[model samples]
Target: MLGAIVGDIIGSAYEFNNTKRKEFHLFTPKSKFTDDTVMTLAVARWLCGDKEHRKETLVRHMQELGRRYPTAGYGGSFMRWLHNPEPQPYNSYGNGSAMRVSPVAFYAHSLQEALGLAKISAEVTHNHPEGIKGAQAIASSIYLARHGATKREIKSYAEEQFHYDLSPQLDDIRPTYSYDMSCQNTVPQALLAFLEGANFEDVIRIAVSLGGDSDTIAAMAGSIAQAFYGIPQNLASYCYALLTPYLRTILNKFEESIGVLTPDPFDIERFIKAQNDDNTYQQALKEILQGHKTSHWIWYIFPQLKGLGHSTYSQYYGLADTDEARTFLANPCLNERLREITNALLIYKDRNIERLMGSSIDALKLKSSMTLFDAISPNDIFSKVLDVFYDGKKDRNTLQIISKTFNGHISNN
Candidate 1:
């Protein structure tokens, strides 16, 4: 998966320049992740979200991520499909389907499973027969490479199954190949590059030297190369450094969820420290108060502190003691809603915690257990104003004044 992202970034600069030689620097200042990396990460995220690998899940996640990154160099038709209120396959035969199917290889346990998942991954956008075939071929090659199949065996199987012409050498293909996006044209060349390369880097270089759709081809080849050669530590680190923190976090979570290796507790501590150092908590709180959506950093980080003893919570919040921390944690209404909001955010349900908080308050109106004022302790108007403010239905200044006054009352009580 990292290999595919690295390859995309490496080839991004040359995608338009059409370099036919492998002598170009692997990483340049202009290098960036494109649609290929985005969709690949989306697939990994979707897979991590559930135990079942359903087509609807793939479609939903892909569209969600796609909408998040509108200028990710997606094909025009595909972009339209992504934004459609009711998204359906547009019958694309483009290589976008194959470039993003790399994660299918890692998630499947058997060749049959890989092929089935590959089909499901592609048919959501690229349901054309050639598109489906291209994805299957790339995924099967990756599956075989990971399971220790030799290059000759992989080539033989791809040829027999997908009828891709893999006989041409890189030397022969480099001179004449031009930019092409069709799955039939690109997948075989990318596979050939993988089949002939000595290592992961060699595979990317060979794929780029073909000089057509450089990033997508290299991304396809890199996926196979990663399975066979395993990415070097230095290269993997370099690639990871190029990703945004959000993408890196998803990659880490996806890898962890898929049994790539349990994260070291020390590494997790380091991650927490990094988040704290970045003032992630302060930013999340500000966003909540200002009626903006906060990142999932809060959802992930708060849970670690939540279930710990009140002493730990006090330490986390710089409170004076366990009793002081309990002012917030001991409030059943607030605590229950916080848990629900955290779960919802983890699954990408509601982006705004403030909105979710307000919804929880509204739901209280229909419940017999308690009203918001009763839950928050006998401040009826204060509770209603808090709900309205958090829901973005009232003035910010009024909300702040009320919030401060309410906080003072709670503290005195």
Candidate 2:
């Protein structure tokens, strides 16, 4: 649920001023929660508040929250329903249904419960078939992800059950996609972004890069990504900080109700001071970006990587600890270009940490990303990196510069 809210806030700035590029800042001065966060919290409150799961309860919460955050960029029809004395299902097919449905996934113990609850949540206003389907599809994907289903299995289930064509890659979808609010147009693209992403942050970046209803698309994708690949601690802290106290209180209750302990946000001042105190944090980033894959820096930094649930990135990747992460990073067969791109990804991850810190990610997320980076074929990694950092357009000069810089470093060594 926080993952969805994080995406909403990050993409909020870019929703109106759409940027097809993924290199933009994750947050800005203008960034804030929108209708997506408000309605999502409403659904969450309904799930946690009402033991009977009544539709009337859902409607009341939605109306109350919506009225409180009236300028949250809600669609006109939904706004009318929020204020109406006799609100009814408007039979709308908007992506709003999918954006707010993530909480149902976290609250459900089984896939069927997820689908059923998703239906109840959507029908309050979006009684249209696509709206219900959209909600169910996202809810089911997140449920499957949390239950340890592989991406392939989740993709097959969504394709077979929801009949969404998850086959189209983001590279193919980004060039021609436009501003679309309908569930049919929004849900599939969001799901596809999740399917193609390398990590949780990667998924958000991919969804935002698609450039249509950016926040909702990223929100839907981020929810599933969080289920599949748990969010980094730094990112989670940023998410919590951007939210209101009431929203955070509801979020805390919702998580507690589901048997999940809400993580406390890191003290930014202390975190920044820790970074300044540890020279290896900066040194590791510098050496890795310079194309030297030393295991000692990784070992040094792993101890400082404090996270919420999982301890280290290696563990997240199913390995034991920093030793396993080091072994994974020391892949012998990666060609020159693949190694350079891997270094570039490490640099990219470092930048994300800097941005979020205002500053080490749980370096576990970074290590796990590298572990996955090593597992994928070189071609796919190259394509994904270009799509993300280079905006899906392969700029040979950039690759050439990375290669040359790496070669220069090797010669100096």
lDDT of each: 0.69, 0.72
Candidate 2 lDDT by residue in tens digits, 194-269: 9999999999999899997999999999999999999877667666655555566688889889888753442233
In candidate 2, the residue pairs with backbone N, CA or C atoms under 3 Å apart (3 or more residues apart, or in different chains) clash, namely 313-364, 354-359
Runs in model 1 lying further than 4 Å from the true structure? 262-413
What lDDT would candidate 2 get against the real structure?
0.72
**Model 2 alpha-carbon drift over 4 Å, by segment:** 266-269, 272-413
Tell me each candidate's RMSD, in Å, in order: 15.2, 17.3
Q: How far off is residue 279 in model 1, in Å?
A: 34
Q: Model 1, residue 43: what's the lDDT?
A: 89
Best candidate, TM-score: 2
Highest lDDT model number: 2
